[model samples]
Target: MTPPRVLAVAGSDSCAGAGLQADLKTLASLGCYGMTAVTAVTAQNTRGVSRVMPVPPDMVRAQMEAVLEDIGADAVKIGMLGSPENAEAVGEILGTLKGVPVVLDPVMAAQSGDGLNAEETPRALLAHVMPRVTVMTPNIPEAEKLTGLVVASLDGMEAAARRLVAMGCSNVLLKGGHFGGHDCPDLLFEGETGQLTRFAAPRIETRNDHGTGCTLASALAAYLARGLSLCEAARQAKTYTSGALQGAVSQQLGSGHGPLAHFHSGLL
Candidate 1:
C-alpha cells in the first residue's frame, strides 16, 4: 500500500537536529512517507551553525522536479532556502502545481542564534513563496522580519498574523517561542473563513527546543498529506511538537540548544 507522501525542501543539518533531519523525523513519526530536496548543507552541531554551503539553485530545482513529477507529493514543507534565487526557484515550481498542501516555515535562524537566510531572502520569499504557502508558521522574530512590525505581545502577534494572511498565505500560525511565557500562545488565522484559533501550550522549560520550528511545520505537512484539514493538521502538529518539547526535558543530547526527541513515542 502506498502511504501519503510529504516532500521536505530544506537544508541538511549536520547535527541531525533540524532542517532535513528534523523534517524527516517528524514526517515519519506522524506516519507519512517522506521525501526531500536539500537546499543547503550546514557544518555545525547543536551548539551553533558554523558554515552553510547551499546547493545550486538549478540543482535545487532539479531535485524538486524529479521527486514531484514522478513520486508526487501529497504535501510539501519548505524550510530555509539558502538564497533569494533558491526561494524564487522553489516558489516558481510550486506555483505550477495546484492543490498541494505547502507549509512554509520561513526559517531565519538556528536555535543557537545563527543566521540562515540572506538579507534579501525574506523579501524574495514574500514576493515568491508567500503566495504558494497554504500555511506559514513563523516565530516572532521571523514575523517581525517579514512584516516589519514589533511583535512583542499577543495583540501584536495577532496584527502580524493578519498582515501575513493578507500577504497571500491561506493561514498563519504565529509561534510564540522566542519569549518566556507560561502559555505559548500560537495564533492561527484562516484566510478563506476569516476564522482564528489559538493554540496555547504551557512553555516547556528546556533548552532542547532546537529544530522545533522545522518539526512543527513538517508535522503539519505530514498530517495534510494524510488528508487532514488545515485546522486538524495544525491541531495535531502542535500536539506533536509539545510532546517533543516535553520529552526533551528528560533527554541528554547536545551541549547548547539540544534537539527535541521527535521519536518520543518510540523512546517510551
Candidate 2:
C-alpha cells in the first residue's frame, strides 16, 4: 500500500529538534510520506532561538502549491506560522482541501521560552485558521492566549477547550503538559458531538522534550491520514509520543532541552 501523505506547514529548525524537522521525523516514523512548506527559517538549537527570518507569504503559498497541486495531501499539519499573512495563506489552502483532516499546532513559543510568532499571528489564526482546523492543538500558554482563560487546571482546560470550540474550531486538543503535574493529560473536545475525551500519560522527566508539540500534532495527522477516527488517532498519537519521550530519557544531546526519539517504536 502507498504510504500516507502529510504536508507540514511550519518553520525550519536548525537543530532538527522542532519545527519542520520534527514534523517530518514524526510523520515518517509513523509511516507517512512528509512534505513541507516552511514559513520561517530559524537559527535555533535546544538552548534557544537566536534569529528567525520569516518566509514571504507569497513564497510560502508557492511552496504549498507546488507540492499540494502536484502530489496532493491526505492530511496536513500546521505549526509555527511566523506571521499573520502566512497564517492566512495556510488558511486559503485549507479552504481547498475539502475533507482532508488538518491538525493545527499553535506553536507560539519554543521549549527554551523563546517566542516564535509575531504579536498578530494569534489573531490571524483565530480569524483564519481555527474554523478550518480539524484538530486544533494548543498547549496551556497557547490556549490561554487564544481563549483568554486561565488553563492551570483540568477544569480550566475544559473551559478553554469549550471557548476554542466556540471560537469556530471544529475540535480542540488542549495539551496539559505545561500544567506541571505527575500525570500529563490532554483534553480533546469534539465540537460536533460535544464529546470530551481525556488522555493521560505519566510525565517523563527529561530535558529531551523539545519539539514534543510538533511531534504529537504530526503524529495525529499521520494517524488521521491512515483512516483512524479522531479519538483513536489522538489516543495512538499520545501513545507514540509517550514512547518517544520515554526512549529519550537516557539520550545526552545539547546542553539544554533536546529532542524526543521519534524512531523509538523500532530503532533503539
Candidate 3:
C-alpha cells in the first residue's frame, strides 16, 4: 500500500518536540509519508526558545515547490512560519494546490509562553493563508489574537469559531486546553453546515505535552490524507494525542516541559 503523503511547512525544533520534527513523527506513526519545508531554525529546548532565524522566503518557496512538483502531497500541515514573508511564500504555494486538505495550526506562541512568530505574521496569515485552509486548529490565545476577542470560556470558543468561519475559514477547531478542568473539550465548527461538534476527553495529567498542538494537527492531516472525514479524523487525532500524553507520564526527558511520546502506540 502506498503511504499517504503529507507535506509539513513549519520550523525546526532543536529539541525535536514541535514544528517539523513533531509533524514527521506523527505522520510516520500514522502510516503516512512525511515531507518538510523548514521556514525557520530555532535554538530551543524543553524550557524555552532563545533564538530563531527565519529561512529566506525564496528558499522556503523553492523547497516547497521542489517537493510538490515531484512527490506531491495528499495533505498539508502548516505551523509556525517565523515571518510574514515566509507566510506569504507558503500562501502562494497553497493557492496553487487543488483538492488537498490543509491543516493550519495558528502557532503564535509556544507552550512555554514564548513567541514564535513575527508581529505581522498573523496579519499575513489571515490575508494569504486562512482562505485556503481546510481545518484551522487554534488554541484560546491564538483565537483571541486572530479574532480580537477574549476566549476565556466555552461561549467564547464558539463565538471565536463563528468569527473565524465568517472570516473565510472552511472549518475551525477551537481547542479548550487552556481552560482548567478535568475534561478537555475541543470544539469543531463546520463551515458548510454551520454546525458545531464537541470532542471531549479526560485531561491526562502530564508535563510531557510539549508538541501536542503540532501532533494533533499533523495527525489530522495524516488521517485526512487516508480518506477520513473531518470529524473522524479529529477524533482519531485527539485519541492519539491523549495516548501519547499518557504514555509519557512515567518518563522524564527534560527538566522543563518534555516532549510527547509519539511512539506510544509502539508502531516502531
23-129: candidate 2 lDDT, tens digit per residue? 99998888899999999999999899999889999999999999998999999999999999999998998888888999999999999999999999999999988
lDDT of all predictions: 0.90, 0.93, 0.94
Ten residues in a row with the worst lDDT in model 1? 259-268
Write model 3 residue lDDT over 120-156, tens digit each, in one string: 9999999999999899999998999999999888989
TM-score computed on alpha carbons, candidate 1: 0.97
In terms of lDDT, the poorest run of 10 residues in model 3 is 259-268
Taking all chains together, each candidate's TM-score versus the true structure is: 0.97, 0.98, 0.98
Error of 3 at 78 (Å): 0.3
Error of 1 at 224 (Å): 0.8
Q: Against the true structure, candidate 1 has what lDDT?
A: 0.90
Model 3 TM-score, all chains together = 0.98
| Tens-digit lDDT track of model 1 for 143-232 | 998899999898998999999987777889899877786888888889899888988888899989889999999989988898988888
Model 3 bad stretches (over 4 Å): none
Give each prediction's root-mean-square deviation over alpha carbons: 1.4, 1.2, 0.9
Mind sharing the TM-score for model 2? 0.98
Error of 3 at 165 (Å): 0.7
